[model samples]
Target: MTGAPSPGLGCVGAPRLLAGLDRMPRLDRTAHLGVHGQLPQLGPDELIALAEDIELRGRGGAGFPFARKLRAVSRSARARDGSTAVVVNGSEGEPSCLKDTALLLHAPHLVLDGALLSAAALGAEDVVVAVTRTDVEQSVREAVAERGPAGRRVRVVRLPERFVTGEGTALVSGLNGGAALPSGQKVRTSERGLNGVPTLLSNTETFAQLAVAARLGAAQYRTAGLASEPGTVLLTVAGSTVVETPTGTSLAYVLDLCGTEPGQGVLVGGFHGRWLDPASARASEVSRKSLAAFDAVLGAGAVLPLPQDTCPAGEVARVTRWMAKESAGQCGPCVRGLPALADVLEDAVRGGGAAALDAVRTRMAVVRGRGACSHPDGTSSFVASALAAFPEEFRDHALGSGCGRRVLGALPLPEDENPERLVVDWTLCKGHGLCVDILPDVVRLDADGYPAEASMPVPGRLRPKALRAVRRCPALALRIRE
Candidate 1:
């Protein structure tokens, strides 16, 4: 959970998102009034037209066009027979990301204003603001409460702080009182979501940007950032502070602002994002067009620089393990393949030679494009990019001996707050093999045809399946214990 906003939030230079943010400590109604003046009341058509004029993409990892999403939801809502719902995805599950929490905690009214504006535009009466942390939940509820009757229309739902829970469909699923997991199929949330009606779901920052753009209009908003990607973006500088910087800010400048020096590789985007070569990162700017020139993504506005003292290979290994642990474990690829990839990477990091290198390549191929969600794909990107960016370190670990440095936990991992593991009561087992039949991804049979792989963390996606398997067991052998 985020603390007081005093030191944690601000802008580096000229603040757009953070503009009028500093004057008041916390952006209450008075502070919000001082900062943004007033919410720009826009009709659905006007809002969509203004979004198109500004060419605003989502601030979320997908970088989808906001105008397109708005139109889709509007069209879907018109075609459907039920009411539409709007969701504010405030679940900042990425470990390196703090911008969403900071913005919600500080300038929450702006986010709410954007949501309400979108809800009104989409002809949606029900608005759901989903957050993960207690403080953020309280802050958003308080912000909503400040609006009186209008605020009461917005429903704030608290969610689990899992990495994939912030996913649009997952948020919808959770809000609908189902398991908070991405579906095993591709379905646009706009067409069918939130009580099975059309839903306009976007990141917290995206809504905040909408509020800013609604107030600033197209021309004024374009005055600050790049021609290709205009407006200020919120960046969660992992080692430093959460600041709202212009879209086309230089990567080197961002690094410098975060107290990082040049010639060190930086991980642009969040954990699911890629790694940039040191020189390439410095030469590039933080815009979609600019980074696309180098075939990179400016994902989620998370810029984490690699610590100079830490071994790049070791750091990758450590982060890979965490990513493996974070797997939703629904698909076979993510559940089994991630740990396999992590093991191979660790082997290569520990000087396990050519076999391990071959295994890494092979396993990466095996894991990619196999998950219900992008967890497997994103993990592959993270690992593949690390291998490409730090070839020398991989070479040293593979060819010579090792980097000789211990794995420094440069990247952050959520503390193991929930250490629950799935276990099977071997004594109660009768070799039924029922558990294997149910959740083949997480459970397998031994050579003797009994259930094996007893102790493991059940992915949020697979919990229902796991529970089904547990109950279906004739001997009542399988159980989950904390």
Candidate 2:
């Protein structure tokens, strides 16, 4: 049987994944081939009107209304220069998220149309698409290279693939050639981004949706999804179990939208997202506030179903460990607290003592809002949600038995891009043996009283101790597998 028809007029297939997308009218291919007629450009008021008509919310995780973001940037636009910059944030740093890359690869022009239209609407002078050093960047770069005069002012910026690097502020910081980390100083990218210029920055999918809305108008755009949401949403569906469903599934998978069949559970938004029973999900709408009411949001466009065979607690623990490692190590809370939380989670999964669960909760509370960015907050949300959603799993594990299966690492983790283990600067080492003392399971001292055996699993039981070791190390010679 043929797959479901694509959603919306411009593109179709799975809202997020672009499998079988080759037959569709790809915006990227059209622009790259110098097909200017197909590219739609809207003036500021027209673009604003289009945005208002569709009632398009930001497609990024936050789900801020597009019109609000536009207004914020427009208000910041200087009267003297009448100039603003549009930033297309394609940095898909969330390990489990692939929606941004899918759009960049399959429909580059859609995003460009949105950005260019928004820029014109705001009287902005420049458009910059920020992507990570991945295949997505190469595709976007080629698309940019192919644009004739229309793409002249548009540029593609390649960024590091760190977790925090994709945050709006971090992306702006990286574009300025600074370290790719969010600043503690409260500042809006719209008020100041890419060299202190007034800017309009949004996720790539947001721009593509804007482009579609501009062409189709609000009434046409509202035909597909719920009245409250008013448009189809792209969702990256990843799970162990696969289900065969009809094509053209409506965008609003609201609680009322989903049929009677019980869903296992869903990770709405991305890693920094929350969990809800698939059954409970049926009652939830796809609107920003609706999802928020359920303690969830339509984040960076990822909605993953958890298979029954896989243990949710085990999965949460694995992702927590990965999140711990992804810390940029700039702040004490993230640098120290995440590993501690991860350790507790790993212990809980291993069926450790009640102390382990208590430790995890304590560390999560300590780490929340303590990072230079939202990394800790996101990590804490994932863990806390899992604990709340799967009380039975936590109770079973607290008995100090086991979850019975090995962690499958269903949630993606950034692999060690640097293949080597921790390199100790021996000269910096004063033989304090704090590393060994804190993480005795992983780090042990040699007969000479020097640190050795650094390649063992850091135990969850010793997280607090390990953090003390990390803090007390005078030489700072000890490092995790980078």
Clashing pairs in 1: none
Window of ten residues with lowest summed lDDT in model 2: 1-10
Instruction: Give per-model TM-scores.
Output: 0.84, 0.77
Alpha carbon deviation, residue 246, candidate 1 (Å): 1.2
Model 1, span 1-482: residue lDDT tens: 33323226756567766767666656887778876787878888899998998888888788899999999998898887858989999898877888888878888998998999999888799999998888888988899888888888899999887888888778888999988888877779889988999889899989988988898889998898888788888877763478778878887887777677554588888888888878888889878888888778888888778777777887777778778887887888888999999888877866678888889999999989878998899989988988888888898887647665543455655545564567988789899887777677677778999866769676433444466677788988888876
Candidate 1 TM-score to native: 0.84
Error of 2 at 181 (Å): 0.6
Model 1 has a clash total of: 0
Residue-level lDDT tens digits of model 2 in 286-398:
55666777788767756666656666777787677768888878898888899888877777666677887888889988998777878888889888998988888886876
State each model's C-alpha RMSD to the native: 9.7, 8.2
Off by over 4 Å in 1: 1-7, 418-482
Misplaced by over 4 Å in model 2 are 1-28, 31-37, 239-264, 282-285, 418-482
> Evaluated with TM-score, which candidate comes out highest?
1
